[model samples]
Target: MRILQPHTRPADEAAARRIQDELRARAEPFGPGPERVRTIAGVDVAYAGAAGAADDQLAAAIVVLDAFTLEVVDSAVAVGRAEFPYVPGLFAFRELPTVLDALERLDTVPDLVLCDGHGVAHPRRFGLACHLGVLTGLPTAGVGKTRLVGEHAEPGAAPGDGADLVHEGEVVGRVLRTQRGVKPVYVSAGHRIGLDAACRHVLATAPRYRLPETTRQADALCRQALREAGTESGSPALS
Candidate 1:
């Protein structure tokens, strides 16, 4: 696979928004075929604060899965610190270096990637998910526990129900009801797909938990890698 790079900076809402529009223009909506998907990888990152003062010591993790069986097949981890301050909307700036390193070791180019962050549901439509997807040109989806931007009506309690995450009258993403009565996850396309398709893909991956296996495993890998890379200051939640 090829690697790509994007211009990124502090959380400039205006800049992010411009990038979002550009991305939206290039985004190609595709059919949600289970066959189009085979190997899935979940990506997650964690942090251990820096020495003295306050600094982000982050770790990135990726867990690859067989799309058919949803079993984890491979995984990798990387760690780094923020080159700059934690600007509000530009989190990818803080984490991408480590994340990319983790991704480079994969044996298979996943049919899809499940990212633990926002995508088009962002103020600039270029949140961590979008940034990473565009950089890698991978079929990716953002599955966040919270919304970084946009609004949505309460989704239904059923596993398959979801509501649009609207911002400025346009659907940026979705608030998905992954499990009955539980807090819904924020869903969005990072690259090469639409909101509806992103929702479908996320739902398809969720055979059991509120989160898909890819994401669940990615989160686990992040924490585990952190533990393995010892000699740190403040410990982060999980990895």
Candidate 2:
């Protein structure tokens, strides 16, 4: 995996925000993404210390799955200290370095990448997913457990039902029901993908659960990696 490392690591909140502002213009939130995605990758991060701690031991995990069967095909994990301070809207700065490292370790180049965060539905219209996609040039979308910035009526009870998520008078994403009677997930185009296609992928991948298997697996893997790192370092287990 040849991952592009273009942006220099930002040293402060101002620099991080500047990077976001510069790269955000390159994000293609609506596009002709892969029509037949054979594999999908999910990425997530977990921390072993308290939030915003500079010394927080964190782990990032990337899990690739066969889109059709939803079986794990490839996976990787990277454990490291948080490089940047936690900022509410600039979370990518804290997790992206490790996430990219994990992604670079993967053998399979996924046709689509799903993130456990927001995409265009963000305060700056550039969330973790968008940042990753712009940097990797991969078709990506965000399957957020909660809304980052948007307002929408509840989707219907049936699976696949969705409603537009509007923010700042623009449609940024969708509130989609992946499972009947389950809380909807926020679906947004990260890059090289459209909102409709992103929602379809979410529904297809989340056949049985509220969240896509990609997200669930990656989330579990990152947490496990974080715990193991903490144990090896003689630190207390993460709560």
lDDT leader: 2
Model 2, span 70-137: residue lDDT tens:
99999999998788887778888888888888988998899999998989999999998999999988
Structure candidate 2, residue pairs in collision: none
Poorly placed runs, candidate 1 (over 4 Å): 6-35, 50-55, 231-239
lDDT of 1 by residue, 1-239 (tens): 33566445444545645665665555543445234777888898877755221257677889988877888888888876655455557666667778888887776677778888887777666777777777788877789998777878988889989888898888878889888867888988877666777787788788788998888898888887777776555577785
Candidate RMSDs in Å, in order, are: 4.9, 2.9
Report the error of model 1 at residue 132, Å: 1.1
Which one wins on TM-score? 2
How does each model score on lDDT? 0.75, 0.89
The Cα error of candidate 2 at residue 116, in Å, is: 0.7
Error of 1 at 147 (Å): 1.3
TM-score for every candidate vs. truth? 0.84, 0.94
Clashes of each: 2, 0
